[model samples]
Target: MTAQILDGKTLAQRLKGQLQTWLAEVSPQVGRPPGLAVIWVGDNPASAAYVGQKQKSCAQVGITSFGGQFPAHTSQGELAHLIQQFNQDERVDGILVQLPLPADLDSTKLLHTITPDKDVDGLHLVNLGKLLRGEPGLQSCTPAGVMRLLGHYQIPLAGKQAVVVGRSILVGKPLGLLLLASDATVTFAHSRTPDLAGLTRQADILISAVGRQGLITPQMVKPGAVVVDVGINRTPAGLVGDVDFVGVQAVASYLTPVPGGVGAMTVAQLLLNTVQSYGQRHELVMPQFSG
Candidate 1:
């Protein structure tokens, strides 16, 4: 059977519209718009594009964008100091440090500098700990977005076999935890995992977050499994995902497209996290948006 598309772009747009409407109604009472500080460093083209999209999304949803690009030579101490400043800024409800900071800079240290309340990227140890404990906290955007997409589609998770084909803290590891919390039996596979296809074929839900293109082929997928492709690999043709889309589309029952799927959801969830932090800070009741 041909697979159904998950269509995250449409869902993301709907979420943005809801946020815009809610923010328009609440900003007057709040006296200021919720703010997001995105600290981008260097001139990485991909990072620049991502930052622009995030800023544009913030403007659409009434979240003021703060922070700007820094030079590649910008020191770790300088970045840390800036994060501290954003941490203390009352108007800024969320702080995010764009990834792949200069090799010399300590990304972990800089990330930790942002207070847990304002760590919108949810990479801080505190937030990760909260996730480990299954407590309410700002979640890593991509994983949260993946979970949101799965929930939106009403895919069964309880007691199902869910295989995550990556182990990075950002997406794979955390996403496994999310599936486990939903009562899905979760398995994690990585580069060194033996018999990768054998592992994936056993999954009811298959997710590939590893950035390698064409990692998950049709033969690796279980017929009728839901496949979520979180990879964003740029090639001469265009951006593509880990899954062999055309091949897997015929194998898996449901699938997420490369550009319009998890990537769009990531930005949407970042906004959601920021808004959630804002509501918590102001003691305002935030309305839930469901699929």
Candidate 2:
């Protein structure tokens, strides 16, 4: 079967439209637009670019974007203090600290320090535990985006066999929980799994988040399986996913591309989380999104 490409760029644009409408209605009631604060430590070029994209997206949706930057050597205490202040800031609804913090800083402590309500990245332990218990909380953006993509394509997850390759907290674990929540039988696999392709071949729905390049080839996919490529690897050939796109497309019924698939959805979901934070903090009605 020839695969139908899931167009995340177009889909994200549509979601942004929904966010704009909600912001128009909700901001007036609150007397201000929802505010999102993004903090970055170090001069990581990639992190800066990611923050810039997020800030631009916030502006488009009428969410105020506040960015704070620090040197690579910024102390853990200083960072924590910043988070504490943002948590108490009446105007700030969502707080995100870019990942890959410098070696000197304790990542775990930093993540735990953010207030659950303002943790838009949704990495705080309290939020993580809430997700583990299947309670209502903002989910990690990429995993949330994956579910959105599935819903967008109307893929039925109930009772389906799903194989998720990867075990990172950022994507794999949360994704498995979401799939399980949807009643899909999920197997969380990784590089350590023997015969990785053998497991992947049994899945009705396959998701690859392993950062390694070309981990899922056409031979690894079951006939007509739905494939979602969540990996983004920069290579000499440009950006590619964990799945071998060209070969897998020939075998899969539906596939999401590397640059335009999960990546775009992640950015869109970040905006959604910012909006949700506003609703929760101010006791305002949650905005609706058709996307």
Candidate 3:
């Protein structure tokens, strides 16, 4: 049977429409639009593309942009000072530092400088802690986007065997905690995990966030399992996800495409997180969308 596509591109568009409506409704009361500051360090092409997409989405949803690109040699103290400036800016609701910072700059240290309330990227430990405790908080965009996609399709999560391949703090670890919060029995596999196929074959819901293309082949997937490929790899063939999409499509019951799937939803969730922060700052009730 051909797999049903988990079309994140379409869903993200719909979510953006909803956000636009919400922003229109609240901007009058708040007297200002919600704002997002996306700080990009260095000139990484991928990071630049991602930041551009985010800023464009912000404008579409009436969120103001309070950010700019930084030089490659910008110092940690300089970046930290900028983050603090955004944190204190009443017009700014979210602050995000683009990743793969210049080799000398400390990403972790800079992340800590952003106020937790305005940390829309949800990489701050405070928000992650809230997620671990199953409380309401801004979540990492990609993982939060995954959960939102599954919920939208009304996929079963309770008591399912969910395997998350890759244990990065950015995606895997937090995503596993999210699935666990949904009552899915979660196991994390990484580079060192032995017999990887053996673990993946048992998953009812398989999520691969590792950047390695073609990592999850058809043989490794359980028949009829839901496969979400969060990987974005630039290959000889252009862009591809972690799963061998053509092969796995013949086995899995549902799947997400590389560029249009998790990537699209990631930006969508970032907007949602910003709106959430905006609402909190103004003591206004924000619209909450489930599934």
Clashes per candidate (backbone, < 3 Å): 0, 0, 0
Candidate 1: where is the Cα deviation over 4 Å? none
Which candidate order results from sorting by lDDT in descending order? 1, 3, 2
Each candidate structure's TM-score, on Cα atoms with residue i matched to residue i, is 0.99, 0.97, 0.98
Worst 10 residues of 1 by lDDT: 282-291
Provide the overall lDDT of each model, using Cα atoms, as 2-decimal numbers. 0.95, 0.90, 0.92
Tens digit per residue, CA lDDT, model 1, 1-291: 999999999999999999999999999999999999999999999999999999999999899999999999999989999999998999999999999888989999999999999999999999999999999999999999999999999999999999999999999999999999999999999999999999999999999999999999999999999999999999999999999999999999999998899999999999999999999999999899764
TM-score of 2: 0.97
lDDT of 1: 0.95
In angstroms, give how far residue 278 of model 1 lies from its true place.
Answer: 0.5
- TM-score ranking from best to worst? 1, 3, 2
Candidate 2: stretches off by over 4 Å: none
- What is the Cα-based TM-score of model 1? 0.99
